[model samples]
Target: MSITYLEAIREAQAHALRDDPRVFIYGQDVGAFGGAFKATKNLQKEFPGRVLDSPISEDAMVGMAVGAAIEGMRPIIEMQFADFSIVGFNQIVNQAATLFWRTNVPCPITVRLPFGGTEGGGPFHSQSIEAIYAHYPGLVVLTPATVEDAYSMLLEAVAIDDPVIFCEHKFLYYHLKAEKLPSEALPIGKARIAREGRDLTVVAYSAMVHEALVAAEELSAEGWEIEVVDLRSVKPLDTDTVIASVARTGRLLCVGEAWPWGGVTAEVIARVASEGFGLLDVPPQRLNAKDTPVPYHPNLWMAHRPTARAVAAAARKILRR
Candidate 1:
């Protein structure tokens, strides 16, 4: 049977709870409600007291996790929606993120965010918040696009003695699947070449990775070999791998579901232009969601986020330059 991206996450948490005595899950409705997306489905029943429910306050949830981690416990905090994470902005960026650096005690906390857009989620429910968390130091921001990465990276996040922002795309929870969970995975902070090509490179992460691959396939039909890079971790971005890909392709088009202003796409283009400027034949281009709050209507939502069609169009435009 095929395992989905959401199932992979549940399995990873089960593994962590089974193996680590200090590991526990705490969040709003996670214990009994199985999380907003059922990412914690039946985990409370399986683990019993290990999974606990908290109040609706995101700030309080993260604060408690930080305290628990300080006392030698590994706490996983689940944010129902990515946008709601901003409610705990202070605790995440200041308290949890700076705890270890300031006190020399490892803060092992994992915050799972059900990120990205689904049709009709609107501005409040649908937002790509990875770039915001990635801006801070002492926080490991992960964007898992595939089932394997969703499983393995989460396990790794629990193992690391640092605050981690696990950004799992809500759209991929049921849409993407793998034949089976992986026994091993690429190390964190590494980028995977989803599709190899020589004409141009499309650097993307999370849900956008699949879009990039689809764009690559579409372009391939027209004799354009497009390379797609899946950035597993944004904070510890693998610039070397991205630079190497750009060197071979001689063109770059960064794609993301987040808004254009200072998002991951902008970061990728900036890095390629600064570190690998000599490797490009044309100026690096990027495609992102419109610079407005995510829309509620299905048609507007579809137009708001980057898609296979938009990515392919952007790639073609960059290629022609």
Candidate 2:
């Protein structure tokens, strides 16, 4: 039997609750309703009162989690949608993020964000907000691309004595699967080379990692050896690994589902240029979702985000240059 990305996440939470008595899930409809995407499905029944639901207010939910964490509770807050997290931005960036640094009291809260675009999810439901949270100093931002990372990373996030933003891509929940849950995993803040090559390196995370893999395979047929790097975490970004990959490939192309302006892709390019400029044989390039609100139409939605086809085309352009 194959376990999907969503199941891996639920199972990880179950494992955390079983092992750590201080760990509990708190969010809107997370207890009885099992969360908006059913990420916490049947968790309330299994763990009982440990999985309690909160009011509709995102601000209140985060604030309560912060208070709970201050008192030694590891609370996992699930945002119904990535876009909705902005409602609790102040609580996240200022309060939870600064708690440990200001008072030397660790805030061990994990905020689960069901991020990225889906067909017809439109502007309200679809958004990649990793870059926003990653900007802060004290917060650890994670974007899990595969079923294994989805399982392992959550366990690690809950154990850390710091605030964590876990961005689990909605597009991969059901679509990506593995034979079984992983027994071990790469530590957080490490980047994994999904594919190895010499001609170019494609850096990506979340749903965009799959697209980069597809693009790499497509290029392989045309005699272009493309390397694909899966950036497991954004905030504690493994710049050393990224720079080494660029040194080997000598060409860089970053891809992301978020908009082009000031996003993770831009950060990756900036780091490569600043740290490993001499290693790059060609100018580094990147592809991202168009700078527009996610559209309601299926075709427009496809066009709005970076697709496998678009990634491959960008790689071809960079390889040729």
Candidate 3:
């Protein structure tokens, strides 16, 4: 049985609500309209009052979730588009993420971001903003790639006691196909390997995981066996697994849709170079979007970001070097 990205997301929401009374969802068009991408489709009818349609205010939505978390309720707040999340930066970075540090009180909330490009969502709705929270001390960021992950990690995010930024690549939502998981998964700081090889290792998260896999396949066809590690948890990056993988392959290529300036790719490359340099055959390479704002035009947008071919090219060059 195959599932679409949007369908898997909705299934995860239902699983959370049914498994935990503390978990609930609230966001713009989340109730009757079923969200901008219909990820919350029919949830309002299924959960009734549990699924709420919030006002068109990201800040208020985040603050409300934070307040609820302080009172022992686990609330999952959805940003219709990841780009709109900037409006709630104060609530996220200052209030929600700092709650435990400030008063030793954990903020049990999840900020769900339906992020990434390929929808031609234009500049406003397309840019990946994981870098915005990359520097924040307490924010736990997680991105799910496959359908099993999409269905399970939401449960993990809801179970965590700290604030989480749950980013889902919108482009992968309906396009990807896979079997479903049983919907019981652990916390927000977990990573998994999607493919295994000994020649080179490609690390990525969210939609970039697919790109890495395609890149691996292409390289394999060319007699270059490449491994793909999905760094699902961006914040508490499993450097142990990444380092171990790099030790086996002796080469690494990190891929992400974030800007090249201060993206997740930069963080990954730095850690690999610093901690895993002894095991490397060549310098750690990274694949990221250009250091510019997302473009409105589709052709320019496609050219600006890293692709499967681009990742394969980078991986091959690193292997050769």
Candidate 4:
């Protein structure tokens, strides 16, 4: 049976809970309500007290998770929306992120941020905050693009001793599906070449990876070959894999759903230019959401984020250069 990205996440959590007695889920409405997106549907009943609900305070939620981690429990905090994670910024960046480094006590806490733009989600609900958390050290930031990755990576995140920020794209929750969960996956911090080509390289992560693949297909129809690289985890970016792709194509186009200012796209470009400057035949380029608040209207929201059409257009520009 085909499983959706959302279902994969729920299954992963269930698997973690079943396999490890120390692992539990703590989030707002995660108990009876089954989470804001039902990502934890029926988990409370199956796992009982382990899938407990939390108070409305994000800061308190994260703080409690950190304390639980220090005491040897693996706690997963599911932020209702990615944008709201900022409310607990201090606890996440200060306490959880640095606990291992400062005290030598591992904080095995996984913060699940259902991120990325969805129609009518508005500025307050839709935001890609992965880059913000990625800036902090001692935190592993993961962005899973497919259903298989969603299941496998989440399992890995819970198994990891370091603090993890798991950014699961909201847009792919129900839209993307796979025949079965993966038995194994590439290690975290590794990049996947989604499609191979020799003309140009399009590096993307999360929801943008699918868009880049679509753009590659579109370009293929025009007798242009485009390679698409999916950076599975942005924080521990695979610079070697990216540089190798650039070496083959000699052209790069980084795409991201976040705003265009100093985000993942910019980071990828910076790394390529600094570490692989000689590998490129042309300057690396990037495309991102307009530098503005996410819009409320469907049409405006569509225009705000990077789409397949926009990616194709950007690829064409780089291809012609």
TM-score per candidate, chains pooled: 0.99, 0.99, 0.96, 0.99
What are the per-residue Cα lDDT tens digits for candidate 4 across 49-153?
A: 999888889999999999999989999999999898999999999999999899999999999999999998999999998888988998999999999999999
Instruction: Name the runs in model 4 displaced over 4 angstroms.
Output: none
**C-alpha lDDT values of all predictions:** 0.93, 0.94, 0.87, 0.94
A best-first ranking of the candidates according to their lDDT comes to 4, 2, 1, 3
- Model 3: per-residue lDDT, tens digit, 109-218? 99999888874678888879987886899998888887777777877878878898989888988898777655455445667878999998899999988888888888
1-321 per-residue lDDT for model 1 (tens digits): 999999999999999999999999998889888987888899999998999898889999999999999899999999989899999999999999998899899899999999899999999999998998988998999999999999999999999999999999999999998999999899999999998999998999999999999989999999999999999899899999999999998998998899889888888888888989999999889899999999999999999999999999999898887
Q: Please report, as a residue range, the 10-residue window in candidate 1 with the lowest summed lDDT.
A: 31-40
**Model 2 lDDT per residue over 68-185, tens place:** 9988899999998989999999999999999999999999999999999999899999999899899888999999999999999999999999999999999999999999999999
Name the runs in model 2 displaced over 4 angstroms: none
Each candidate: RMSD: 0.7, 0.7, 1.4, 0.6
Clash list (residue pairs), candidate 2: none
